[model samples]
Target: MTSHTWRLQPEGTAHDDRYDARADCHRRLRGPYTGLGTLLRSLVPDAHRARPELVAHHAVEILSAAPELKDLIGAGPQTLTSLAVPNERTRLYPAKRTRRLAHGIIEFLHGHARERGHALALRFDRVDEADHTDQEFLAILLRRALPDLVMVTVHTGGTDLIPELTTTLAAHATHTIAQHPDEHEDLTDNHKLALAYVESDGTSHDPAEQAAYRRVDAAERARLHDQRAAELRRSGDWSLCLGAIPYHLEHGSDREAAADAFLEAAEYLVSMGFYHSLLDVAGRGTALMDPAEEPRKYWMLGTKVTTALAILGRPEEAERRYIELRAMFDQPMLHIFSGYALAMLYTRYYPAEQKDHQLAKAHLNNVLAMASLLPDHDQRVFQSVFNRNGLALVELQLGNPTEALRLVSTGLADIDRELPAEKHRLHRSVLVHNRGRVYTALGRLEEALADIDTVIELDPNYPDYYFDRADVRRRMGDLPGALADYSESITFAAPFWEMHYNRADLRLELGDLAGAIADLGYVLELEPDELDARINLASLLREQDDAAGSLAQIEEGLRHHPGDARLLCARGLLALDAGADQAALRDFDLALNAEPDLVSALANRAALVLETGDHRTAVADLTRALAIEADNPDLLYNRGYVHQSAGDWESASRDYTAALLLPGADRADLLRHRAECHLALGDPTAHQADLAAAESAASSPNAAADPVRS
Candidate 1:
């Protein structure tokens, strides 16, 4: 048995071009799963030939999503049509797509593994420069793949990686620092070393090579950069435009070309929802040109920077940049862009106390005003509709559903009347989607469903439309319809944890317990620290009488979220079930200390204390629990029993009367308890009447026992 060692470079080393060029590249421009594509080629160079069934079954679908793989495996039929189309409006989130690619790669690896007697060792280099999608894929692979299949190592160049990947690596991988050999002898010829560095697309991490390159004169360095940029350009690799070209151009003498390349990369990243990458590229572009000299490019980059900032939840920074742009350029388009960005900041991204819908509306109004100043008629109309859609969101947040509906309707009407249906299809869908949300808020279920259905028809490949329709159906009490729509959404884009989480809830409602459990387990697989999913999974496991599984889930959730009141309460309930009364009581105390109003903890603690004959404490806990759930018949009945136990006849009578008024209350039990209380109070007439009522209720077929502390 021979063990294979594969020295992979996430951002390739000096000798590699394809992997280096693909670093930080947007998936839309180069297609997704490039990292997995490289891995597949390395692992099984003739995978299609070696494992035709596997390629036909698993690799084809992934290759369809990643066209770059077509050259490696030979292009096949478009099996996953939903993922094949590269529409910015209908694409899955980067994480979701990465998960799908990871699944396919795991399957491919497992298939390859069966032929090998020993596990392969994978060494990933320069992971710090890898794209977020690649990082996400690697993280998922590390977490989900069997350890016996592959041994993995990562080199991060002493830089901080994304938190999730870093955490996963910390837990699953051994940590070691690499010590480079002394290379001072190699720095003697600076010019030759610099040339070699440039030829390598500047991917060298050797200290001596870097020192030699820096020793070269600035003009010579610029010449080298220009040469490297030209070579990359002549390579005709589109991904190089995003990675090596922009980098070399920025360092070269061509400032204008650098700005252009950065702008192009930023736009691609924006379309791909790589907001963090967009911010970096847009910032570089903004630095290359002056707002006054090249106002269009400079402000275009500025707008992208601000938009990315807002989306990334740095609204304050976005607001400051927008203000600076507004001060520098008073152009109508700049104002319109800035105004909309500021409006969205307030409407969606700002902290709760800082959120001001009125201010957002004011900004949108300014945007609408600027729309009229546009020279082109189409531009004017499109800007008007776009800003009006934003205004609809602001109005919706402002608690004016009617106004929001009017705004969305007006925007849709403008699109229909003035613009061609094909011109702004994405924006048109957005307007209709907004109308659906407005309709949902107004309790117009049928109208909401109709609007969502229209959008789904218009853009059937978009997963969110199906998710929206599913929610609407769920709200309309159509569980089967909602479940079908949720399944459709999952089919279009798998590994979206929210869709799986929601589908689990619907499955539970439909009594598909196994399906619900599978969905929840999948959700946890995709997002381990999803607290709600963990809590729900634990509760469901408990319901299924899987005590060990339920306890394990609770412990895992507690590990992730220490002192979480809900998990603590759940743990307490598990303890109570296991007859660990003291442990249950302690957990209830801790949970209530964390959250005073946790009703489950209070109710369970009340039952435990009542069993211990602490009538005062039991009454107090039940009273507190009742405050949170005033209509709960169980709490009322339990409290009435506690008061009767403590010899408070009048209070017991009052509580029994209150419980009898609620639906599902045991009429005979309440009547009997109240009759005892009345007798204790020396009210013979009332006692006799209550006894008669209790006798009649007990004789009825609907009567049943209602135990205390139920």
Candidate 2:
């Protein structure tokens, strides 16, 4: 019991964080299944988390505001109530389901906190007032060994408890405290003082009273800002001094010092990912500098501002400023820097209509030339390798994967030559990962896996690396390995939908229809307009004899895409399964009308017509289907059935023999059917041989089953 920890504290309901945290956790675990693709349904729920690179890419979108970053953001505004994972839709053990939900929630929140560099605190402040189900959830959470999880519970006195919760608390209780009024009052006072000092006023306030009670008029407040700026300058903390610059400027405190602080702060913020703040400082800092006296300072501030604009997704403004900077500054380094930033805008973040890879390549080549002329050898090498990395990305965007891989490989070699082992570790990781991506695109799984393995060893915490490896393993046919990688990705980033979609596909391949269906359903929930997931789910349901479920799903899809040929074809399948032959025929007719070349609809309607003793109509349908798919065994076999029913033994036998020669042929069934045709034609020798072959085929361990494929 000591292995688990549980604490009971009674507090106001409004203060409880557990419910909100639990709700968020459930959403993460359940969100990805909304629009499952056929392939992704096989993975565990964890793989549903967002990959790290996508998240980083999204961060750029937020900082840059560039509307043209072409990537699937998510399944927007879809929900799980209308669609769900198969397990949730079906009846499951209450205890097991609850435990999974609870554990998944904990893991989801933990991963989120880890990625954002924050602490996770799960506080159930008034458990005694909660319902039995919630109480059970708390108990289950306490029982698990969650890493870095802070679990706190509150139980008010005189409240009834469920037996399981009572037993859980008795065994795992860590502490029970009776807080004193004076101690509580002192704690409240400290909180008030801290809030007043920071939130209420960070500068000049009345020193006659305690910090918490200090107040000031507008003039006094302005004086306080000036005073705080002076204090920060005296303290000599560059970072804090920079933070105070805005306040000092507003109060008209030391214009020269404030301008210096602005330049330093903007540079510092660039490294810390405060792109927006960098723009603010650079914008005002340039205005403060006298261009005639300090042209260099003005140029530096302008360049910084331009780069910030580029990174923030304002390519037009950045390009304009870059042109201005080039005209104003003669420094080669500034030109190279501007060229590099502009190149990235065209390569990675350009609007689709504005994409120009040739221009991007030209800019990158300019960087290469400028860097080659640098006095320092190490600096030149570093810049060259960096440009090569960008060029590799541009080649990838241009659909030259082999060229991309070659460039990235060359870049890595340059890094090895120029930088020490510790100096370019991050760049090395990126280069290896990029090379792996190219390998995956080339369908070279072994090489791809090797590169990804190296990447993971270098940076195991990155979720996207795991996602890349999972895809490589899937392509290699190592389903278990792929699934493991997907799970690892979820452990790092819990809001990714692609992982769920991929896992669902793997599960289907492994014959886990229930798991596959669940994943597909979840995918549909995530992406309601995902037609592939809808079709796959309906198809799987038909296999499970869930014709009504299959029909309902198809109908829902039809509502979204009225008269869609594919959905109509799927509906026809469901109607056939339900034994509504007339309705099936009508659906097939409608489907074929929507898409005249739909082979399945033609073949299936032919089979239905043959059953009605209309051989000529069936033959016409089969011939049309066969014309579209000449080697289709199912079409050939169905046509043979029509000929055999009409007493055309020679034609039937010829068609059956042709079907048997193809792959996925049902040998036992074909042989027996051919024997019937031979017997009808009075060919004793052929009939006897076919009968023997059928018997042997049925007796064999690798016996071919009947071709009942839809």
Candidate 3:
């Protein structure tokens, strides 16, 4: 059997035996794999730096030995590099190239091993320290499962592996080894806890382990700082700055430098849409800093932490951090940033009565007031533009669509005039998206669609753009297009309950009842206590004639919200339909007691009263309902029938006349009732006129016949 063995590096240390074996194996395979060791050595602390080139160079060298694989290697160096270059028009994910490289390597290795009639064994020790790009590559390679190759990978276990890496290793690793040391061994408390953390797979609940884990984190962070510094000094690559933050924080050796690194990295990560990582970096960095000594850095770190928390759906934590950061910041720029973050949180997460769009508007106004005091930088103007967009969103949320549109338009004009095109693309795109949302709210679907199209051109992968466009498409009656755009939004960022709910609603409108039911059911599964989703599912079930399923859904909702008037009313309606008059009456009473002005409950209870021959009580309920909605034709018609039955001809005539004047009134029925009333009141001419009008309005012979007098 032909095989190769290599060990991956552990953080803060090296294993010499595995290193020696790697070197020996690459040196022995001099024809093609000579520089494999050199290629591995070139991996820097920054995972994003020229990874594709390294992988491609290694593949090229390997292909030089096997002429049969030349076609697979492609035409030239430019071709290999071009493979790394993503199509900007296609909205490529950041990790796409890493995955591509992994697949390419797997294909090459499998073909080579197969041609040689032997499987190759490759071992990676201490794989935990591999940067994100390398980890992705490893994951894809393992998932591909090349038949002619055997691969082994080892992780240091204490480090928090990304989800993809952890899943890949857990699913594919064939063997495991425990390197846990004896408790009595002469080790530091941090080291002992680190071992325990590793043993328990980071779920150790021991109090000692918890205490040790913090120190271990600090130590590891410091080690990372040392590693990043050394790598940067050798390679002169500045992008490794982000990877150095935790380490610098751990050591507290350079307060200003660490703070600067943290702020820069946090902003870069934010642009890359890595909110979770931004939170980690900002949180760790803020904990290590002295606020008085590094106020600017502290403010920036805290602000970023708040922003990340808000974006990651932790509004309460974001609010707390923002308030603390706001108290610490006397600087105008920091105030603007943190205030805007708070404004967005309030707009999205706060209760309707508690929402502070006015506060958001005030912050933007303050930023504008201080604009002349600031330097003439594009970033300053960009912040102003962003704040205006925030205000527009707040306005939209507050139901001031016209004001929202005006703000978005003025902000777009300000960005065009005050900032250079390249400097404000992101802000402009966002403002355009806000404008689209405003247009959507104002019922201007075509204009909204146009603005969303522009936004998509600027930032196609942004999920909200797709969602907004999906809404526009839905309003425009493009059901398939709306569904596709909704799916696209989910593809970009999945499991959004709002998107699922909206799509289910659209599907129901388009008569895809099963699809609508499935989407609604999935939403309930994700959030079991979602009352609106439960109600919607129940309604859909009833429409499909599944009354039992519908009742079960309403009961489930009642379990979560016992006094919910809407659920009670729904259950009551179902009971009335099933001839459970007592149960129906009880449910309606409960619903009305909880919510006295519930129109549906009032109307339904009146119908139930009419069924039980209590004409006076039925008339009273209908009268109360009509007082609430005086022009409601159904209320008018129902009350007229009750009055006519009780021999009150004049009252019946008044109700019938009112019903006839309302749009969508059953004209033939209303006229016939009025003719009967005229006859009872001994008016021959009025009766004859109504009878003629009723006959003309009626389309059928039976309907044309005069309504029988009670």
Candidate 4:
């Protein structure tokens, strides 16, 4: 053990020389190993390494342009669309995907640390030399990509080295875009060099950086890209600018219709370098055009025109342009946009009659069409916006409040996302109101109350939201809440005719008949054609037995919204109360003609028809009413009365039996009717049993409170 060391003395001199040179090479090459250190140094030069990928990476972030941008920039004197870049492609999935991709790259770097930061640098050329450790390269990439908060500053040039030249360029462009959130948002290919200043101590800077960022020679840059940039350049000239100014007297740029024409003129003026015309357009409107979009691709010009008209309450003009643009190219997105526009137009004015119904249906159909067209990755986006609103409208139109409530609540539950967030928070607020309406109709007080609360939290300014909520609160027997919401709604915007009418109805509910009458008076003054308000006011007057006053109100309302179905229905109800059966029947028939599917009209008409001895016609009307709301206690009782009056005791007994299974029905009365049927059929035992069961069920107040509602 003590003599284990072996001597390496060579026996021959010549043999020793060969071994010396070989060992010297080995000593030089091995950093620690010996030999060939100089040989390795000759091939691998580390100090001048370049990292272009870092620059490109930053370029990608800073230059994302809108898909429609090229057209705007190259509009060739058509005027630029100045809305600027479309927002970034955002989705919740990105959050999930980023963490996983980062984790994998990070783990890979841990295994090969020598090439850590260098590995992420994008390489455009072939490499024939030995490389750094994979772990090192991977670490380098992970460092470049780790989000700002977590990623430390990367020193690519060792302790003293600034980031590569390309990285500096990328950082500049990125920093500029970051500083100016309003402009430089679109990260398109052309804006690549603009991101060089994202991070700096203001020490090491690139000579090419200023050259790239300067827009002083925009004309030259345009020429650099050949005719496309030239086209963008040509559109910014003065000749086209002159035509942009409005020369008309009278209806000047201040008018909404003229405003649209003024914007179109601006496009011409800006393109032709007509600064004077640009000034005129600016005088007419507040929003400015972008110089970048010199030849401006006419902006969402169609969208703007339609929106302006809709705002001005000119649905005819809005619809014309909406249709014109919609037909230019047939895509499902157009349907969503058009339908939304139409729905807004109708909703804003509070359309009545068949037009409101038609618009509502069209709106829903458009949403469905949009859903059908969405890409797989994007399908959930529209769902997040429209699911509750469109479905609730369809449900209300179909008169299935329970089904509507169930579906809409479910839709709200599924809107799960995070971070940058969904852009339609305002629209979602509207959906909350829509759901509240459904719940109100279904008489789900507590659930409806919760939804209305959320709607207020989302948007207090939306006109219809408050009215819908007030209606819900009134149904919940909260008179104070209902009154407050109604008052708040009208206070915010007096042009909302419906809120005035709603407040009036709430006043009547609170039994302040005078107050209700006064509110209705105000509503009618603003909207003389509001038949519902007039009818309600008339009914309230009639309730106070001021028949003359009621009759006068009805006549005046009818004069304005002449022969409205709701008015006829109200007048008929009044006549029936006045014991004018013949007159009541005539009025009900007229009401049905105006709105055939009106449940109140059908039920009232059927009762009149039955009393008039037309049992066959009475039964048909009752049957259809039952189809609409089979669970309506009044409708069911009326149908039973029809059958009994028609001399069909057996059929009459069945109708009464069905009525007993629904809400608000007098179980004792049903038993008596059924017993009468049994007596007529000589069934004493059946009659006795019916009498006992009805009395027992009605004896319990708790039992009576719940309905057999089937």
Q: Pick the candidate with the highest TM-score.
A: 1
The stretch of ten residues in a row with the least summed lDDT in candidate 3 is 23-32
| Clash numbers, per candidate | 0, 36, 2, 63
What TM-score does each of the candidates earn? 0.87, 0.54, 0.63, 0.44
lDDT of each: 0.76, 0.64, 0.64, 0.50
Q: How does model 3 score by TM-score?
A: 0.63
Residues forming the 10-long window of minimal summed lDDT in candidate 2: 30-39
Candidate 4's residue-wise lDDT over 1-710, tens digit each? 01111112212312122211111211101111111112112211231133223212222111111112222223211101122112221111111122222233333222222333322222110011101111122233333333321221221211121233233223321211112122233343333432232111111134344335453255443333332223433555221122212222102223343344456554433322223224434444433333234212233444545554554346677777777766764555556666666765554433454247556666766676667557754454544346345556655766777767766666555443422235444444445666766766777778778887887765555435677777777777789898988887653331345676778877877878888888987667544556778887787888889888888888888866776887888788788888998788888889889888778778878877766799998889888988988888767777777888887898889888888887778777677778888888899999899888877867876444433211
53-137, model 3: which lDDT tens digit per residue?
4334344323322223334334323221123222111111232333433444555455544544654445443344444444554
Of 3 and 4, the candidate ranking higher by lDDT: 3
- Model 1 over residues 1-710: C-alpha lDDT tens digits? 11111233223333222331122223222323335444554555555667776665564445533434556666543222232323313222341444565665665665666656544556555566566656776777677656565555555665546787877776665565655554434447888888877765676656677878988999999999998889878866555666678888888998988988998877666655556657767887888997788998889889888877877778899999999998998777888878988998898889999999999999999889889879998788888988888898888887899998998898789878997666766677778888998999999999999999988877776677889888999999998999999988765553468888999999999999999999999889877889999999999999899989999999999988999999999999899889999999999999999999998899889889988999989999999999999998778888998999989998999999998998888899889899999999999999999999999999999886665452
Candidate 2 matches the true fold with a TM-score of 0.54
Per-residue error (Å), model 4, residue 290: 15
Model 4: what TM-score? 0.44
Residue 561 accuracy (lDDT) in model 1: 95
